[model samples]
Target: IPQFEDVKFEAASLLSELYCQENSVDTAKPLLRKAIQISQQTPYWHCRLLFQLAQLHTLEKDLVSACDLLGVGAEYARVVGSEYTRALFLLSKGMLLLMERKLQEVHPLLTLCGQIVENWQGNPIQKESLRVFFLVLQVTHYLDAGQVKSVKPCLKQLQQCIQTISTLHDDEILPSNPADLFHWLPKEHMCVLVYLVTVMHSMQAGYLEKAQKYTDKALMQLEKLKMLDCSPILSSFQVILLEHIIMCRLVTGHKATALQEISQVCQLCQQSPRLFSNHAAQLHTLLGLYCISVNCMDNAEAQFTTALRLTTHQELWAFIVTNLASVYIREGNRHQELYSLLERINPDHNFPVSSHCLRAAAFYIRGLFSFFQGRYNEAKRFLRETLKMSNAEDLNRLTACSLVLLGHIFYVLGNHRESNNMVVPAMQLASKIPDMSVQLWSSALLRDLNKACGNAMDAHEAAQMHQNFSQQLLQDHIEACSLPEHNLITWTDGPPPVQFQAQNGPTTSLASLL
Candidate 1:
């Protein structure tokens, strides 16, 4: 009879896996619940089942239930005297809370997790793994807060921790404790994750070249690993790397390549329904950025709207709303919708955006709206706020955007000298970022300012620079629009279009694109 019960427990796990693979999570959940109920006598199976059920809830974006399950798992682990597994459960819950921007709740939880990792006198490898997880969470928390400077120490510690892990031969060592049997990730995978987080930090700090360097290294490793082993995590890493690199491409004036890579992300997601469900909103957001860059306001609006509808993440929602407001502002209609969207993301009020960069961007959007309404004084107030926040965090992209817009405002107000002062530094910064759109805007303003000041020679030089930027953007736009995948912008619901799926490997090599 006991053997039959064991078979039933094993059967439930295997069956649920099959159902989940087929995208029948509805069928999988009940089976998992039944198994969990029956497996309560076996702590290991019960804990595993609880974690599995929690992951299913997380995948469905039902964070409330997921957190509850994690809480149960944590308490169960504590009762079983498995501090290591308890840390895992608590950390997982912290991640979900962080995702919802419940920072006040997450802060104390992370502190408790930190204490657990410190006091844990378990297998050295497991301790280091828990440390890596804790450091990663800390780094992510700081980065989300737009505290680039504040995150450096934690990042360095993480890097050193991974190095320590790489030197240890813990892979074959079976821990005496059953709960300590789990490995967080293989050394190679952890290395790639460290590179990913480093790339994220570099990108936020406006170190585009550095971001690209790390991305290239990470992708090369991913590609090689995927060839040897077809792990789903590899695909997840690949998609995320491509997502970051594509944004770099957009900023650095590689729109055609960005579009190609966006399709590649779509194709990668299509191979797994879970991946698609988790990333569909983000894919649409990328498409919206492409549409915005190419001046396709209509397509941009549609893409942002779809992303807004699909996403439950508070920060991502605020981001999408900010972008959608920009599209609305550019169209010169939909004033009512724009106002409502702006109200929701007003940084001073509590729309619950914890990211410093996004809050600064919200101010920039507010300034942009004021500028369009011809409220120069109000616009200047908002833009100045944006500059202060961006400068504090070294958010170069937002700083560049705010500076250029302020210069435009000054130009319109006929303060040619002040305009020149704002536009000149903005141009220099944009050129450093190689942000084509901002560079183009700054160059045009420089040309106008020089012309007004009777500096004909300087004016001609500025005009030539503006012309070149325009031509380059125009060509990229045409190339991007010509691609079949451009139609992906129109896709709002369901799976990715089959036509966009890569028949061969990626159409473009990740290394070359980087």
Candidate 2:
């Protein structure tokens, strides 16, 4: 029979590997339970097992369970003088609090962890990994606080770690024998960690283009690995990266590329429909946005309904809800329900993102909804708020749309020059970014504005631009539609019957929902 101490220790460590690999909580729960049972006489071992269980709960977003477990683990860690584990527990707890936007509650916990790590200052092998993990949390906290300057030193430390890892020859750096300590670990894990640091640093600097480059490289590395697809560790990280890419693509107005990537993701979700139903809905919501941009009203409505069917995540639903409201206003329908949905999205609080650019876009989208309702004064207020925050290299679509809205608002107030000035800048920005949809809409608005002002030369120029951009976009959509049935339905015109039917029953009509 195996020694009780040895068996308990091995089980505790092995559960982490099992959790990372198969990610079957039930499969690993037995191991954790056994470890906890055996460690009942040892405070340190008991604390460690409890911490692992807490982490499992955290991964599932069961914050209440995770908090209860962490509370117990902290007491044991304090009693056993296991400072390293204790610090880690504190760090994780702080991070959880941070995620819940409990910023004030986390500072003291993080401070305690930082002090412990600083005092234990031996150059131990285990120290490096712990330090890296702790520093990641620290950097993230600073990011959440919007303190870019304070995050620089930690960013530099992370970069230095990346460089140090790179300097070691590949075979010598990582564990060689499967039986050796920390063996069977993929070197690409380190790459992914460093890539995350790079991404955070870029985000702090407001450098979307730079962030995209690093994420793209990381994704390429991830694709080359032959790891099991069922790993929760992999899936969790993959979803975050996909969400980031989708956000960046949308902000930069790379709509066609974003749509292509989203469709590919949807196809993957379809293969294992039950496992990825929520993720599929996210893809559908994104597809709805792409459809709206192209003026495919029917397809856009269908995609939004598909998204609403997928899940009830409040944050994710906000995007679809707001856009569907815009669609309702566009269709000249009564939009009281749409207004109610928008209020539901941000009810009784400021937004959670806290990003000026994102807020500006949200306001600008609302302006579009207001304009469609012919509420010109309300539209101007929201659109001007959008412009006040606008800078170079932000979301071109929002800026373009805002300018178009301003043009319409000024036209309503009979101020043609002010309208023309706004529209001209929008055209310039749209031209630089190559967003065919925005370009088409902006050009059309300018053409009408020029005609209204009796500028024949400007009207002729605007008409030509509108016609050329719209024709090219329509041609591309037709080409993309000429594909397999499993492919995304493209942005072509009026058909009597909708081709793609939902396999799931009784999806709420998005029109009704909006």
TM-score of each: 0.89, 0.72
Q: Which candidate comes out best when scored by TM-score? A: 1
RMSD in Å for candidate 2, one decimal?
8.0
| Winning model by lDDT | 1
Clashing pairs in 1: none
C-alpha lDDT score of every prediction, in listed order: 0.87, 0.64
How well does candidate 1 match the true structure in TM-score terms?
A: 0.89
Model 1 local distance difference test score: 0.87
For candidate 2, give the lDDT of residue 326: 73
- Please write out the lDDT profile of model 2 over residues 423-449, one tens digit for every residue: 788778766654455678778878988
Could you tell me which 10 consecutive residues in candidate 2 have the lowest summed lDDT? 176-185
